[model samples]
Target: MAYDEGLAQRLREALGDLPDVVEKRMFGGLACMWRGNMLVGVMGDDLIARVGPDGMADALKQPGARVFDFTGRPMKGWVVVAGEAVGEDADLADWIDRARDYVEPMPPK
Candidate 1:
């Protein structure tokens, strides 16, 4: 399936200033990576965010967020934010920031 291009563009704009950020294809979607770590991605109108293991519960509490179940098994620490949650620029930026915060301090891949 094709990913969401509009969401992908928004993510690109938000991550433009960050260092070592790369846009690549993964999960049958467009993955925005930071130093080879998955930060966020656009998949079928959903925003897939890697919020870290510790932040999983908090991230899932947010609007339109749920466990990222790309395959049969659920991926902890990753979330899928959809609908109005990612429709607003502010929310999207917040997710970006959350992703950056988690991946920014990690050791190089």
Candidate 2:
């Protein structure tokens, strides 16, 4: 499955000056990593985020949030934000920031 370059680019732009940010192809989409940890990604038309267990649960309560079941097992700390949820700049940035906060402070080398 070909990933969406347009979405990938948008994610990169949102990352700004974050250090050690890298993009990798996975799960038929683009996984945006910070210090070797996956913070946010674009899977098909979905914007997936690793927002930790607590935040993950809360995020799922939102209208377009769903568990990210990439490996057949439903990952507890991950959620997929539907494309509609990220239609605006502020919404997209908020989700990315939340994911980044969860993954930051860890060694990513």
Q: How many backbone clashes does candidate 1 have?
A: 0
> Model 1: how far is 65 from its true place, Å?
0.2
* Candidate 2 backbone collisions, by pair: 35-108
Top-lDDT candidate index = 1
What are the clashing pairs of model 1?
Answer: none
| Model 2 segments more than 4 A misplaced | none
Weakest lDDT window of 10 consecutive positions for candidate 1: 76-85
Predict model 2's lDDT versus the native: 0.85
Q: What's the CA RMSD of model 1 in angstroms? A: 0.9
Q: Candidate 1 on 1-109: residue-level lDDT in tens?
A: 8988888998889888888988888988899878888899999889999898999989989989999998989997899999568898999999988888888888879
